[model samples]
Target: MRFERCRMLFGDEDFEKIQSSKILILGIGGVGSYALDCLYRSGVTDITILDFDIYDESNRNRQIGSDAVGESKVDTLAYLYPGIKTINQRMDMAWVADFDFDPYDIVIDAADTTKVKIEVAKKCYKKLIMALGSAKRYDASKIEVASIWKTHGDALARKIRNELKKAKFDRNFLVVFSPEEDKCKEKGSCVAVTGAVGLTVCSEAIKRILK
Candidate 1:
């Protein structure tokens, strides 16, 4: 009965797809953590989360598992959801170049690094829903999903777009982003905005899966 509500909402066929989909969420920070939460609660059983960083006291404000400071984010999350897989490795170009993404039905890029985001986008544009900058912004309602090419007012998205063009990456991919003007240069974040970004990314992935 864990998924009874989801079953009622999605009906039998779509709910089955939700349960069977292989999802990969990169980063276990403010945005990625909520994405994982939404997917798990919605009956996604086969999930693999990747994050190299451990929790720090500063993360407590917005990130899940922040209580386990100095502990591995992926390990802690996997402990909470034993059904999921964990990869406690950095998302560097070397790793991204070799990692196989074909196994996953959808790859959610909530990772912070722009280089890693671009590499992942280049490798798996077809199955990627990336989360753009959610920091320094307070309005969760401003968050929206759009093609990376069409996104505006997000400096991170603009940077990624320029980089992707330099790399000759022509494909357009979906991204969850807020059009709010960034408040400052400092990376200030809150669950209100980051959590909304994560949930929106999860919603987009689910919509694609059911389609």
Candidate 2:
């Protein structure tokens, strides 16, 4: 069980600590699907999801299952994993303001929406966002992070720029945006790139919680 090393970093007595952990996987598209794979493989068994998107032909480029074309993504995952928890509604932090979300050790935003990332950042203790450079989200010499207006490309960048104009974000907070290295546009959405970013998100989660 050398692979147990992944779980051991958390602590000696918490083999299933991750199993008990509550993770909110927002969006079940390219990044969310792969993010779930990383979390599940790493022994994170408890999860809550929020997504209302039905599988469509457009999703064929990158999604969990090709057969899932006509099914609800969240429902498909629930059916597939059986034990993983799921939420079938889209997130609207304001209207759903009263809903109680238990604190998460790390919140992964594969939702592909800037608004969702901002919502999770405001609600959760820590947040991770996946971004690819297809759109110029401002010019960041390095890929680590960019302020709301710092990014120039990608759809996420535009959305963030708009949000920042409203002055809602906290500059002091730690919000990490990971633009896929090869990017979906240039590299095309390979399971390789998606899987790597997924692994990166989970790796960041481990480092944040364990270190």
Candidate 3:
């Protein structure tokens, strides 16, 4: 009954695919959390979340379920969404080089670090939907989903593009980005924008799975 509406919308075969697809989400911040929420609520049960950071008082403003300060983000998420897997480790170049991504049907990159995003783009380009710079913005309506090369106005996306080019990443991958100008210099976040970005990323993943 939980996914009755989703089942109605997607039909039985596609709904089954959505439920069975293996999804990997990198980062458990504002964007990733909402993406995971959208996926799970849509009947996508098999999800693996990866994050190295612990919840902080500052996270309460934007992050979902940020009640436990100093607690592992992955652990808290796993607790909140039982049956989903959790990896509570930082994604670095070394780990990225060694890890195998063949098992996952889609990889969502909501990570804050450019290095990790580039590495993920290289390794998971065929099945990646990355989030580009959700912070320091306010307008949720400005969010757009496009290939990384076509993205503009996001400094983080620019940096990732440069790194990916230098790394000889020739494949194109979809990304959720906002073209709105930053409100200030400081890295601040609003759930309105980040949540919209996250939901957009999830929507892209759903489209891919249905295809």
User: Which ranking of candidates, highest TM-score first?
Assistant: 1, 3, 2
> Residues 1-211, candidate 1, lDDT per residue (tens digit)?
7888999999999999999999999997999999999999999989999999989999999988889999989989988877999998989999999999999999999998899899999999999999999999999999988999999888899999999889888898999999898888799887999999999999998999999
Candidate 1, lDDT over the whole model: 0.93
- The global C-alpha lDDT for each of the candidates, from Candidate 1 onward, is 0.93, 0.59, 0.91
TM-score between model 2 and native:
0.71
Candidate 2 lDDT over 21-41, as tens digits, reads: 667777767767777877777
Off by over 4 Å in 3: none
**lDDT-based ranking:** 1, 3, 2
Better of 1 and 3 by TM-score: 1
- Local lDDT at 112 for model 2: 57
Superior candidate under lDDT, 1 versus 3: 1
**Model 3: lDDT of residue 201:** 91
User: Candidate 3 on 1-211: residue-level lDDT in tens?
Assistant: 8889998999999999999999999997999999999998999989999999999999998887799899999999888998999988889989889889999999999988788788888887999999999999999999998899999988888988888788787799999999899998898889999999999999999999988
